[model samples]
Target chain A: MPHERVIRHGRVEPDAWRFVGLDEGEDLQALPHGAIVVPLAVWKARRDALLARLEPLGVWLEPHDEPGEIAADLPRLALVAVRFPKFTDGRGYSTASLLRRRYRYAGELRAFGDIGRDQLFYLARVGFDSYRLPEHRDPEAALAAFGDFSLRYQGSVDDPVPLFRKRAAVEVRHG
Target chain B: MYRYDEHDRKIIAERVAQFRDQTRRFLAGELSEDEFRPLRLQNGLYIQRHAPMYRIAVPYGVLGSRQLRKLAAITRRYDRSYGHFTTRHNLQLNWPRLEDIPDILAELAEVEMHSVQTSGNDVRNITTDHFAGIAADEIADPRPYAEIVRQWASFHPEFAYLPRKFKIAVNASAEDRTVLKLHDIGLELRRNDAGELGFRVHAGGGMGRTPILAEVIRDFVPWRHVLTYCESILRVYNRYGRRDNIWKARIKILVKTLGVEEFRARVEEDWAELQDSQNVITDAEYARVAAHFAPPAYEPPSDDDQAFAYAVASDRAFARWVGRNVHAHKRPGYAAVTLSLKRAGTPPGDITADEMDLVADLADRYGFGEVRVTHEQNLVLPDVRERDLHDLWQRIRGARLATPTVGLVGDIISCPGGDLCSLANAKTLPIAEALLQRFEDLDYQHDVGELDLNISGCMNSCGHHHVGHIGILGVDKNGSEWYQVTIGGRQGREAALGHVIGPSFAAAQMPEVVEKLIATYLEHRVDAERFVDTVERIGIAPFKTRVYGAGKELARAA
Candidate 1:
């Protein structure tokens, strides 16, 4: 794919990570050099073994194994990718935001599995810094959707001060 | 009414553009129909039987006269020159082209409005007491807090998608008017021992196929942490709420299955992580929003003017209206007047563009340039002076907006039902039309006294049938529409779901069934006992035996 793959802070970048889905069951011993994303079940079961490896590692959370459940293991994970299972099932949006805001998982938060161009904008605002788009989607348009709104009301992973606080700060400076 | 600030305005403007792009993509076949459904629904656009229906959120049911006039203009230009006020206090335009929705949203954004999350599986428009600031019994106005929550919840990334549609209602009055117990999360404003305002939180209450009253989640949460507390609840619901079954998707079901104790424990787990979060509302933030809802300028107390006294004393029609449609206000010389939308033979909340403009003009003249939409599906002029009420009443009556049945039999709360809603099992407007015509006599209705007849086209309870004094739910029986009647429901400080009377009745037998229920109540009444009071005093058995013949066992629990 020629178009940029991930949008972070209104800019896109080429994809790098290798997502080894649970269905694939990739051989952990013979993994590629780049970052490897494994399933939650795999991560939980082989936590000791995976941590001992030299290569970078992360876990992909399905809708049910949300960020709230894996809080204790968040410190060592370098790239947390939350799978949508289905684009319409938005439980991952909460999982992504909580990983960034609550669990403080300061890794590359990405959206995977059934990800679409339209959902990328919302997913990005909620703190997904990377994306693994479905094969047919246009990544160029998905990247442009990130800058769709220049103003927002609530505080989020991207902007900590909500609009009201921002307005208050502006008022104090101008007055 | 709360005026939007620059930030609020800009957000709405950008939202219009955002939805515009989404609509453009959908039209160009960049997004599939399945993908576009949530995008349109969250923006308050629904595909109905014949045309695309647009729902405009009237947040907390308070809007300026100028906003209403704008709505009139929009409905006239884009739709069929009218809009219907929803039971959730939204304005619905029944006929609009799918392509025109973006333009409509753009027009709405000019007035600091857009229908963001009137539907879809997200946090819907937060609701509260229609008589928020003006009511005499309320400890404090809840609109400020409601606004704060509204801003926070708007475009909230994490909560944008959920298992099912979520609803929140706030009440400041000692007596709940917004039906707090029927919401996903209910907040009641009260003061603790230190005399500082806080909220009594109720979670998991909702009306649908399964009706359950919300149990108390927390005794009190201070005003400063309201937003954080709410976010905690949403996080738990989003992360753990069932996605396998659409039937069990609402937060109410999650609360039921987990039990309120476990639900609170899960929420506390979420709140524990949010202790030092920036989402905590500051005093300055609360005050900024509160300033927009400051009390209307009130005049000093005055004795009843002779003209007002004489007008009511001489004309029994005027007297009956003043008796039922008017409510006491906090200001001594002021009154709040409810303009009945449930006129005979009309859809319950349907108001023409002409009526909209007229109501706006009346609100400017007699009120503080504001109108309120109530949960009971009516409009309220909240700041009318008692001295000017007679003339206001006269003008309102001339406009055909005056129906002297506020809480009486004629003031039915109904949904658009099968008329426009694709999910409805039956058309509800005809039922409303029949009941209104049957009980057109003011004396007959007044003598009948204080009955709430709520109807829903389906079990979604958009009509809030579960909490009505007498609830009627539309059931689909192998292709025909049947009405199931329930009695003794009440919505207030002591909210209770109605009990099913018996087997469902056909369309023709509904009025007779309701008449029989009323007749039974009147026979057993002691002095001023209402239909609800009488039913409560006795039980549903007498009413049941009368409607379904003697010796019939109860089919459903209350």
Candidate 2:
């Protein structure tokens, strides 16, 4: 099979994990082989069975799925991926921030589906560690988007201290 | 005016570069139209009916003389010889080539003005009372808070792609000049008995297709926590605001569907986590921003102004202009003057390049080096010496900018309807022209007294017709243009939406219909009673009866 490219920390890398999706009423017994990410519903329904099988488990969420649902499962989970149905559907940014900040999810957080270079910087600010680039976009050229701005005003998961507080700290140090 | 710091300047410069690249990619056929639409719109570029419309942001309605000169230069160089000032305190260049926009943005960045967040689904330019800081009845200077909010909302990563366009307005004065009730989030700065500053926060108010007044989400949010509080409101709306339908996507729909109480509860729950977060505003930061808005150097305050009194006594024209156009300044020796843009022949908010240069010169000479754009589509020199009234009046009269009808019948707020806007249902400028011709006489208009006659081409309410004392809305009937009239709407301390009088009328009969309504007000009004007051005292019946009852009078008048 051809390599599935992922932009992780502004570097192009081959994606290692395979996403295993389940349709309605599909049994979780038939699963993909290597390090795999399952749907949140499937993981929730067959938690013990999936834990029993040693496939290095991870879970992915749809746009409407709340991060709180997977809060308690963060410790055991290896990675969490949020799906963006469309580029403009921005609920994933908020969800990513909640997972990192509120739920304190320390594992790898990834954004997949319909994302492009334009969304990379914003996704990084909200604590997404990896991105699945569309097939048409060149991953090497997309790295330029991360350095688009040298300054930001608001606090986010990347920098919890806002610019104003940083400026205040500078003032005190100079004094 | 607040000058951009190096950090602020860097952000805007980077944004211009980013947009330039985006435009190049789109032109190269690398990005689809759907993908490029939001990117271009967030930078305030719109594909309009005839050409691309570029909106330049005037943050909190403040402009320096140098910036106005740069705008004038850009207008003359890039667009047609004129640009329209929008009711949101923005400047719209109607006819500009798409390729020339990056260069225009670069020139704009030189003057520290950018069009970011002027359109699209992001936090728009924060607006406040045009008379902020100088208004006699103001509780506190609202500019600092507005500037703070502007910085916080600028290029916000999380809330950039909201369900729809969001607007926030701050007001500290007793009067609601900023249309506080019509914004998605309205912040009213107040002081408690202990002299602590806080905001009476209202959320979910809007005026598009469905007009709903915002409810008090939090009666008092301390100044320190204002940013976090605003974040809570935005986050709730961002996560849950409907994205399926464009019409029902505003926070107002979400607020209405869940009810204000539930909305408030969700916001409070969100705020609980963010209140102590790093986004909490600091006193040092507030002071740093507030220092930019401190009062300009003025002569010693004195009640006696012999020159001003002599000018008023000598020239009746100057006295009339003073009576109508000049607003009372908080300082004894100064007054704020509104330069009327609503002359008879021209469109309401349209300003030519030459006129812009002249206004810039006038601002430097007569007042402070700053000017303000009123939401009523007029320019204000916020700090003019009272003694310069006669000189200023004489200087501006020849340009027809000295119209003494600031709040009168001739002062109509209108949107660029079908003549320019693709979304408009009918042409509004011609009707505005007809009304201006009918009420051209200064004496007749002054006799009519304070009235807000606003016209909108559609339900978007860009003209703010819903809050006009006499509102005219354009409706499409059978593929033809028709006018719908509403009565008794008033904005200010008590903001109320107008009610429709009767049925819609043909476009040609609009002036006559307005005449009939004004005649009814004159006939039924008690001494010194305003048109809206008379309509309120004796309801909309008499106006309706006259406007609908008089078909013969229209023919006679025509």
Candidate 3:
């Protein structure tokens, strides 16, 4: 199995996990314990069914909602999954922020779907901890996205301090 | 104008350092062009046709003398010694090296300013009427609310990267100087029966390849929920707004696809969840922000200004200026003066270094040490005492800033088209000069009664030619200059795009074509009907018949 990063809420740690994609009406009962992936539409439609099934196996399911929908389920779930859907659909970004700040969901937040190298930094800021890109994409490229910018103009998940507070610290150090 | 408190100052300073580090990383090649693109854009730095253009935010079009001087110094030090004031109440410097931008931003930060969110797909500088605090018809000063929105939208994590650029404009006056209908989100401040301030929210209005007039989404959203509600709208747009096609990327397209009713439903649904969260403004926070923009210590002055009247009567030039430049202020003895840049031969909104410094000094002496930049591309003194009009006129005249033609034919709004902007197809300044030459009579212009003559280099409509009463759009015909004339466009409360009269005219014949149209309007108009009202009444048929007839006649004669 390839190396995997396990994210439960805002924290990241290494874990031995395998990919388990779910199809519509597929019995998730056969899935391995821990965490599993599901489509956003299917998850929304059968949330109760999947929750009931997963409760017995000690597995948590990550429902990838479109970015704006994440705020609706705020303060309830411990872990929410966001999907890139496509390389460009930025809905996941707003979803992650809504989940983190608006809902105050402190559980694991994982990013799956069309996650790739270019979007790692932004995903991190919006409160995504573990990234699950496609098998073909280079993990190094995705990891490099984390260090693209040394500074950010606004506050985000990666740093709770607003840009102003960060700048004041720098000013004091230099002044 | 909103004074910066410690929180505001700290925010701007932090943004500067963040941009500086981004610039450093970009230079070090740690960040590729694709990676650094949005980051730099959020800081208001754009690599345009020639060099990087830095757009500095002037919230609600208000600036102090100190800020203006700082801008002047920045231009002198780093840029090409000039800056262009945009329709969104921001200033743009066309040529600045990439490495020098951080220094420029740092200088801007010194004056409590930043270019944050001025560009990119994020929320842009929140704009309001240039006459926000001073307009006579204003219900309340819109800047405080505008400043509040500015803080809420600034560096917002969720809406930072939308499908396309977002613009929000607030209009507090009956006369919509901010052109509320042409923005992505327009908030009109109105009072209910209880005299509580609320906003009539209009959504999805924009101009580009696809121009759209906004639809009323909410009749009354309480002023306190302004930030939370706006966040909800932006959140919806960010998630569902189209990103597949660049042309179809704006919230306007999403609003159009979903329809206003469905869009409003989704927004209301989103707001229902977020309203009680931290996004909602607390009463204490509201008072804190509002206090920064509280009205300055204004003492009631004697209304009797016999001296100014005497001065104006004594000097013919001064009288023309006072008649044209002076505007009714909200205060009893105060007047707002517009220093026109529409001199006959100069570029429409181009102010030289000397002129800028001179204006800065005038702002310090005559006004309350503050200056404003209008969307119409003019400078304003928001609080000039009626008693000081004559002395102010003399100072402005000495600097050649007294153009005595605000809202006249000479007060044309021309884009820096083909000469500067790479997107432009034809030259706009020459046509503006031609119009100025033809209409030398101030008495004739004042009689013409408030015509907006706008010229754009191309259909990109940066000059907002679509909404000009007499719109001139530049077109390229067989590699030579050609112009298209449109009539009936207006940008006020009843905003409407102009209709093209007929075939395009050659460069030489533009003055004659415009003159004929004006003459037609003068002849056909019912008593006191402005150009727009006349065109609305008579339709574009008569003007088309006259202009096309003249075009045909000129062609045959040629």
Candidate 4:
């Protein structure tokens, strides 16, 4: 048998968690542990009430408005899903960097919406742990984009020290 | 010149390696034409009308003798023994082979230069007043800020692919010699009432396809926020600029569509979020960069020669040359001289390898081992001492570079049109040659006085035909080349786009048309008025009626 789906807050049925946003009367507060996703507006409006209940059970938040705002709640927020809105909109990348650096939030940062194979390396550089591929895209091909460049010119979250610093350190050691 | 730091050197080396791999993959068929197109473009290699053309970046048009020698060596090795200096202060090699591009890039990297970001839908070579540090009229040197912008925009992950290519020009000079209004982002450095240096910013100006003048977006942006604010504007453009049509993809189209007020508001909104970011330049960093561009140590010479004045008064030919060619310098005993490349029967902006070596040698001997490539497609020795003017003039005359037509009609701005560029509709060089031959009389040219005649092979406006006081555009009618003339376009501080005078004339009739236009200007102008001022005063009606009607009649009779 498949693993048992855990539902919280008594408002949602375990079987109906996969497609919560489609229904008008769906109770987002009682979303199942693994599959449910919430819109940014709903999460922002009832964030306090949702955090009160969701903190104990450890729930994932999809499309969080302020990743920095909810960073203190990272122990419970298993995965923070960021939205791209458009491929060229780079605010989410900055938001992710801030979440990782300032808050030291180690939970998975998943990027979705218009995320293409070409933008993967940059996403990785800014601290995105995983990506929700756009529908109809091959995940294996998209995975290859993460390592397109073997070397980087600048320092980033993934590599806190720049290439020059590292090279100089190595040179000093050998010299 | 800003010497490459370790980081800068490493970045260029890595970028060269990246391009080498990309080229190898392209040769091995691992990358398709479409896949490799943007990569090659970002590396400044373009598949032009005939072969691949590689534009090497010469940041802010200041080059030392060593860098120039590298360019000369590159020309001799990878391309023909010639290169074209573009209006954006970069150099273009016409005949670079595709397979040997990697080796060429390696050579460029060795000299602290590369073709990166020279062409593409990315931040192109950031240009500033060519006479930045050396110009007497300048309030501040603009190269440090230009270099800062270059570093910030180079291979920027977010802005690498924008709506279209972006150009930024900074001018700190009183006269706006860099044609700031023709750039996408025109910055004028100004000091506030409190004596704080800041920038007055303009946005959305461009020339290709739909020509539009830039509109002032900010009265004064503080110097600290220059990089972050510019990045914010680029971010807004990258997100919202049209991508559907290639022609309408430039920021000018968006500015036109949203109106300048709305565009300014959008940029402000973006800047508000980025104002306090890490990208904001600090005072220390600003000082560090500025220190790199501080003026060279100069001891004031005691010898003041009135020889040039006496020579000019004595010799009419030399006087005419001085009147047209010599520009005042800020230093007491120096002047900047423009060696006109638009000599009769020579292709505009084409200087042979031998000429380049000679100019390089002259720069070492006379002018501080530094040379500048001007936007008007001429070579400038910015620090020629007044005392050495005669000796330098003799040497330049021997090399046939003393054309004595700096701002005259014979100093025509012509593009490498159908002969080189793929986008041209008609041949521009031959037409330029014809006009130059007709206007060869030095006395007649000086009498005409400060006429800007620009020619572009097409409406892409690389030759900046729209802003020329006397503009000539090459057009194709049936199977033959035709020329369209316009009047009163000026690209200086009081920038204005030229207006089309009338119908197109055949190639053979181009010289006659130019003659009639000049004659009309002379007849109708108030005393000492320029071609632009005369056209502005009387309008194109009197000039057009005379040139197109009675002037054509006179030509027919002759």
Better of 1 and 2 by lDDT: 2
Best by lDDT: 2
Q: For candidate 2, lDDT tens digit of each residue in B1-558? A: 798888888988999999999999999998899889889999999999999988999999999999999999999999888999999989999999999899999999999999998999999999999999899999999999999999999988898889999999999998889889889999999987778999999999898888888888998999999999998899889899999998899999999999999999989988998867999999999988999999999888666669899988888888999999999999988999999999988999999999999999999998888999999999999999888878888899999898999999899999999899888898899999999999998888999999999999998888999999999988888888888889888787688899998778888899888998999999998999999999999999888779877444443321
lDDT of 1 at B386: 82
lDDT of 2: 0.90
What is the C-alpha local distance difference test score of each model? 0.86, 0.90, 0.77, 0.76
Fnat per candidate: 0.75, 0.66, 0.26, 0.03
Score residue B373 of candidate 1 by CA lDDT: 94
Q: What is the C-alpha lDDT profile of model 1 across B27-51, one tens digit per residue?
A: 9998889889998999999999879
Q: Is the docking of candidate 4 incorrect, acceptable, medium or high quality?
A: incorrect
Highest-DockQ candidate: 2
**Interface RMS deviation of candidate 2:** 0.8
TM-score of each: 0.96, 0.97, 0.86, 0.83
DockQ of each: 0.73, 0.76, 0.24, 0.11
Single-chain TM-score of chain A, each candidate: 0.84, 0.92, 0.66, 0.73
Tell me which of candidates 1 and 3 scores higher on DockQ.
1
Q: Which stretches of candidate 3 lie over 4 Å from their true place?
A: A4-38, A41-80, A85-88, A97-106, A112-127, A132-175, B303-305, B441-443, B475-482, B506-508, B550-558
Clashes of 3: 4
| Superior candidate under lDDT, 3 versus 4 | 3
TM-score of 3: 0.86
**lDDT per residue as tens, model 4, B1-558:** 688877777778877777787788789976668667877988999898888988888888877777788888889988889888777788888898999888998998888888888988888888888678877788788888888777767766656667688999888998888788878888889888888888999888998768899888898888877876786677667656787788998888888899988899988976886655656665655665687877665558656568877887887767666777777877877777887777776787888777888888888888777888888888888788877777788788877788998888888888888888888988888888988888888889888998999999987888888889999888877867777888999988999999988788777888887888888889987889998999999899887887679455633422
**Candidate 2, residues A3-80: lDDT per residue as tens digits?**
598888779999888887735665567876778889988888889988887778889998788889989989999889
